[model samples]
Target: MAPQDEPATTDEGFVPLFDGSTLAGWHAAPRTFGSVWPGGPDLAGRADLAQADADARAYPARWEVVDGAIEGFQDPDHPGFGGYLVSDRTFGDFELRLEMRPDWPADTGVMLRRRRDTWHGLQVLVDHRKSGSIGGFFGNGLANFHAVPYVLDVSTGADGTPDGLVLEDPATTLEPMTPDKPARLVRRGDPEAFLAAWRFGDWNRLRVRCVGAKPRATTWVNDVLVAEIDLATLEAPNYDADAVAAFLGRSGHLALEVHDNDPRFGEARWARGARCRWRALEIKELSPGD
Candidate 1:
């Protein structure tokens, strides 16, 4: 069924992307990596957005609308079929704001500047597992950017490992890390202040800004600047820096990822992995001329 047509704009210059009632202007994509990327099976069978939206709406076990929020679930009876809900419209430079809360052990993220055929793009991770690496960049098939505290404590160290079991206090130093590139300790912002401001057990405000020309991306959690990365300068082995930089300039859709869990981990694990909720998604377009 086609979603009801509604005004997707507001007076505040923030466009309503989700409409809080329907999945209009959005297409459901299967898990971008294992099922849709390089050498992967094509799980995104149909090409139409309405069909994809219908499929997602029908299977509330995977994606559903609840009280104005987009929710993803991993029911024991329905597992492993995970993917992303991608916006049909493409955006260039923009400021996006949203609130998200993941269930315990669930993993999810907001992906931006994504290419159409594959999931090669940047993402802000909402990892709620014991990993304790929330609000980091997932990189998808591209690159991962993370900010870690510089201070000594139990939950973190200079090497990005848990030095102790207890976090006595917030660390003052926030550093950038690219574990996939084996890179670490790149200074970014005030980690301690970000931690002190982060509110657990509730919806966390996330804001992302992109330049798209030179391709500088910045992320904030609960209004605290946690990471800023220049895609043009990112050093990733086996990846073309020029191509990566060019890819960032391409306008693409905003996708909400429904993390795919390994089936080998069993249904219980899958159920835990697919739980997340998002709300208040709004975006303001910024032109180069502006």
Candidate 2:
């Protein structure tokens, strides 16, 4: 079924993340990675979490509550600035649900099990740009494994503004899989169904359930199942599930990202002055019985 503008009925045991007025339980952690693509941060060594806690206070994003929703954008003074509005509390196994509406040419995502120090975790890609994909997974620091069903570009009208979205074959736009570096993982979903369920130029509901140390993440777009990844049983090259589990542990904070616009790409990663709006953010913690 297609998602409606009205918020989903709150399920039992679910709790609110955003207070709808202020960012009380959140902090900003700016990522200083040279580039956010291919691989986000080095995972060869563990970062000092204590030091990261101290450093996060210094950097902040232009995130604020507007009309009962959290709006995030890049700083106009420092266009190159990019970071996440991170939750102070960490989660282990949980089911997360939210609604997002991003402007054209925006590159933002929901970070899962993210480290406090850097961009290391599983990312649900909301790359609303050329050659980007929605409802997919990106391994931020785990060998850059991309598990998307299809790539997408903006469809433009005569005036050169975005009119709709155009779906493309991933094979044509993304790097081919190889033995040494198999970057792309198999995604579970029908592309046509995803397109039909997606609501262009409007708010879309996203649901994600992640569990275990080496997690099994399942995603839904407007209630259509789009992606499911079992990290422990994954067989992609250079993706070590055990190592990833060890590094990240069983719990981490949830984050909303505002990516930097790199000069090498020629075009901005995030559109100038464009902001992504989020609302109805909530999560339900899962126990062993669940």
Candidate 3:
């Protein structure tokens, strides 16, 4: 039932990352608004995502330890481009599990191997819009912005109406594993079944397992292994060519994100009305294939 990489510290199926008590093994590193890491772009700030902010003395701009959980809030007063609620360290070949409830019109994700100033390999998007978004890249390389493990034939676009169709495309055909044309299912389609695939305004379970050197990964939504990606090209030795020229480049950093520019999502989005915090988080053990 766990996303198998390394077994949880306990054996009750999966160990608790958030023991529902306190921040035991977690660290605090706030990525406050306006405080963009010394990275190149001004893609900085999480102010738009949050309504009010905590005391600047107690929490950093990017994160907080509230009610025994790690949470993010962008300054509603400064609704600019939001940045990542980054993890303090980098991880390799690990398993991760977390739950989040997104606000309406959000473009957010969990980024892995996120170098503060460079690129990352794995990114799983908790997209409210019914876009088949999965393992993509950001920063250094434009790896697979829409490279999904599976491309569904769902009706896409502002004018696309459901036409009752389903199809899959090899990752190579489309650049982002995203569809080439507007994808949609017909109106006579099973509403309950389609909705069941995703939950709106509710806490959804997300799990990821990364292994192997180049680090391929498997993603599970509510225990179903819905996607997989081969990270062979991750070893391309092209990230920060100058940085690599100094040393044998081999690894990357990891972090989480909240995307800006609230695009008009389609009806496929279940949580079209949700707003507020995404809670109950944990990251322990690396489940390889369970």
> What RMSD does each model have against the real structure?
8.0, 6.6, 9.6
lDDT of 2 at 255: 93
lDDT of each: 0.61, 0.75, 0.44
Q: Return the TM-score for each candidate structure.
A: 0.72, 0.82, 0.56
Which is the leading candidate under TM-score? 2
Winner of 2 and 3 under TM-score: 2
The number of residue pairs in model 3 that clash at the backbone is 31
Per-candidate total of colliding backbone pairs: 3, 0, 31
Kindly report which residue pairs in candidate 1 clash with one another.
31-83, 150-173, 154-164
Candidate 1, residue 257: the lDDT equals 75
Worst 10 residues of 3 by lDDT: 180-189
lDDT of 1 by residue, 17-41 (tens): 8778777778776653323323333
TM-score of 2: 0.82
Better of 1 and 2 by lDDT: 2
